[model samples]
Target: MGKGGGQVHMGNKAFSSHSPSPPRNNSGGRGLGGGGMDRWTGVIHVPLSGGGPTFRVAASLIFSPAKTLAVPRANAILFTGDRVRGSGEPAIERLSDAAYLAGLLARKLAGEANAWVVDAACFSRSLAVYRELVPSVDAVGDPRRYDPTGFPASAGVANILAHCVHEIQSTITGTTMKDSAGIQDPNASMLSSCPPRTIILGFSKGGVVVNQLVTELACLESEPTPALSTHNLLVPVSASDVLSSISEFHYVDVGLNCAGAYISDHAVIKGIINYVLHTSKNLRFILHGTPRQWSDPNRPWIGMEKDKMLNLLQDGAQKCEGRLVLSEKRYFDGKPGSLLMHFEILQVMDIS
Candidate 1:
């Protein structure tokens, strides 16, 4: 979505380096900017490897076809499962998973109206990087390790991803909000106005990244951000800007290593609750997971069945007037013989 006339800053040198140069050929394919996947427009590529030995994190942006630009109601930032390699059909299929979920949420918010659509972007990282980021987890079992001291190294990577989301949200919000201000004729503007909400959905290990991003966001929202001071800010913004921008956060079958959610920090959790109650009127966090037996219970991954998790989310809901909801729905309960576990949840998740 075009950002009206405002400037949408991607980031400083770090993100700028990964940006692909504009495509030389410009055809009358779609939108104000002619195109097939406008490298210069909706999408951005952030190279997490940074010319280092470990080429772990990679981010790609995807938006609805220009036709949907008439009514971009909701903006979604989706995180796919980890180690999604190659840009071939396989990778597209993997990314399509996030896109499908994002579309589901968009349609839900849009209601029966078929005019509105959702724009989604996905962030993916390699498992090789996990060993360095989360040293406590056992590589043998994979996605099942607990780092007693908490993941300090992950803060840097998480900050980068959070900053990316912030920039993308800012751009989409500004553009759609402005577009709704009446760029098109009366007949063209959709029945519903541009969405004031942003939805973030994460699945599998990608959910772990979302967890760290939320923790980093909570710390940023604190009065004095000492935690953020330690990490190098790829994109820096005021806390009010970040807090005000986010409308909803969804963790779909988030990875188990996320023991250090908001519950891990009392002050951070308190700050977020007060902020949400006072400023974020419609803000909410949705936690959805599958049955514990379907997930790897042997590993110390944080599951919905885990007592600590219930206590943590329940505490937040209690503090914030039930703004948080935890749900566990069997994904494959049509008298299926096998369990639908972690990955299947994304496939069967019904946003409504």
Candidate 2:
């Protein structure tokens, strides 16, 4: 597979002056294939002015702002933690993590910093977690009664992340888009709203969740209304009616190591790539990971070939015409794990 590139126009404009060009075709030493994939690539260099050690990561996208899509005023971001991390825990833990992610999003949008941090591991068994994450923000539905396993399915997980994005953006900009109808039905409303140029970061189970959501959202883009029902009770809804309202969709997949054993299937990755390639061509997908185990290597956290995983990503980019940018590789020795890498990638400034 080779990277494919073509022109994209944002809104009704003839050309976009803001889109960054794709990265140069460097396939010899790098894992990428020799054929130049039609994709935009760039390096987001954020110097850590203060705080911990400074680090840099490369980023890639499909659209060139210079050719298409007007640069929006603000960039909305959504971050979802790993399954075990996102589940089970004190309410405060979850809120603290959300707050941290919000802080990172704020900093990135303001261009005041390079990275931000969010603890996705905090899990909450009760609704109290919602209170801590957003004291002023109210859940569209009852968190106490809500079952993470029900409704939206794994794909709906992206809706949760999307909801977080809406809340954070609203809190920072005081915008009303968050209150739109899609809050109730993200699958439908997601594509209708044409969400702001947004970046969604998901880990472990969260990655699968986001993948499902993106796939569904892409389907909604064309069909808008699918005769698909959830739990055979919710009834199929019109995605076009809902998703058309949003602007942009940028997906970032981190903690690839935590993806567990199931996601290693090439079919799973290819499914995601095909969806992005055919449906949301403008979307940006990023995969972040390390070669170390979550716990001790002797114990073997999850059986995954680091080389194979990286190759899968490279293949996905080539097959889907999307750029795959790798972050600095970190090794985990038997010691306390540092949040520095997470902070560097997700850290944000106090824009408010």
Candidate 3:
């Protein structure tokens, strides 16, 4: 989606003037698609400024004013796997690890501006899920009551993330849309930075939880009313608000169930695609891990499930036309008998 030279117009009058695009070197080994680089014509290499990982770049079409970004640089919500958040314990250990990720994300988003308000505390510790069915064991508290084991409860997990986004987007006056100061004036450029974008990261079993939550969101998006009556959420939230607030969704080392735990639910899958298509302007997906890990056949139906889920994502990407950027990277040591590297994918932002 690279915009070419064009005139900018508002109403009946065109913008002041049009400037020529930057000159292309056109010489071999330099300009886009020059000689052997035809495929990379519009691509540019951007080194990761904070020294974490290099990001694959595509052409950027939107530009924002150079004003300083105010408080609450971005909102992030992280979901960890089972056993990480001890049953009745305060989830301290997991929170400590999450803080590391929060710092990385804060740095990445802040870029060279050095403005980031996100922290480990911004990420919720964990969202438990169905233990027996999902292949995880609840290590603490009352396993029967705290364990999440079914689709409804899975949906509730998603609702929890949505509620967090809503809360972050909410102002002290209790409104999710921060337009009270005329900041969201319709006349403003549609390309200006969006209301603080929601960043979601899930690791291990949390990846499965995140996927299921996405499935549930897809199901609820089409409903006349997406009920927030689930026991998981501390407060009720509007389904539309939650969906609209999301700008990025990521699943790192999501485990074997990463493929399609809910691919059979076509309505839900379609809802996810539609959400990406219409709801977010620059929404993207970041996926990492070895294919073997993601497609691990721990159960009889898993092989087929993975195929369907991946196929769905492929189809959705094609349908999105260039609006959605999907980035998928693999992290393997290249050594025989190595661990799945599921945990390491989070350190590098893959999949977009």
lDDT for each candidate structure: 0.39, 0.31, 0.37
| Ranking of predictions according to lDDT | 1, 3, 2
lDDT per residue for candidate 1 within 1-352, as digits (tens), equals 2121222322222211222433222310111111232211323333223332221122223233332223233334455555444535542444333323333333344332211111212222344223333344344214342332343323334333343333343444433333221223233235334332335566655554445445544554444433222111211123333334455667666554444321344554565566666654555566666553234545444543344544655677676666545544445443332223455565557654
Q: RMSD in angstroms, candidate 2?
A: 16.8
**Ten-residue region with minimum lDDT total, candidate 2:** 1-10
- Can you write out model 3's per-residue Cα lDDT over 220-260, one digit (the tens) per residue? 44555543232222112333334444556676655532334
lDDT of 3: 0.37
Write candidate 2's Cα lDDT for 135-241 as tens digits.
22134211221122212322222233333323322322344452322333222212122223334444332333334344444444234344322211111122332
Higher-scoring candidate on lDDT, 1 or 2: 1
Compared with the true structure, model 3 gives a TM-score of: 0.49
| Range of the 10 consecutive residues with the lowest summed lDDT in candidate 3 | 7-16
Ranking by TM-score: 1, 3, 2
Q: Count the backbone clashes (under 3 Å) in each candidate.
A: 3, 50, 6
- RMSD (Cα, Å) for all candidates, in order, is 10.8, 16.8, 16.5
Clashes of 2: 50
RMSD of 3: 16.5
How much lDDT does candidate 2 score? 0.31
Pairwise TM-score winner, candidates 1 and 3: 1
lDDT of 2 at 21: 33
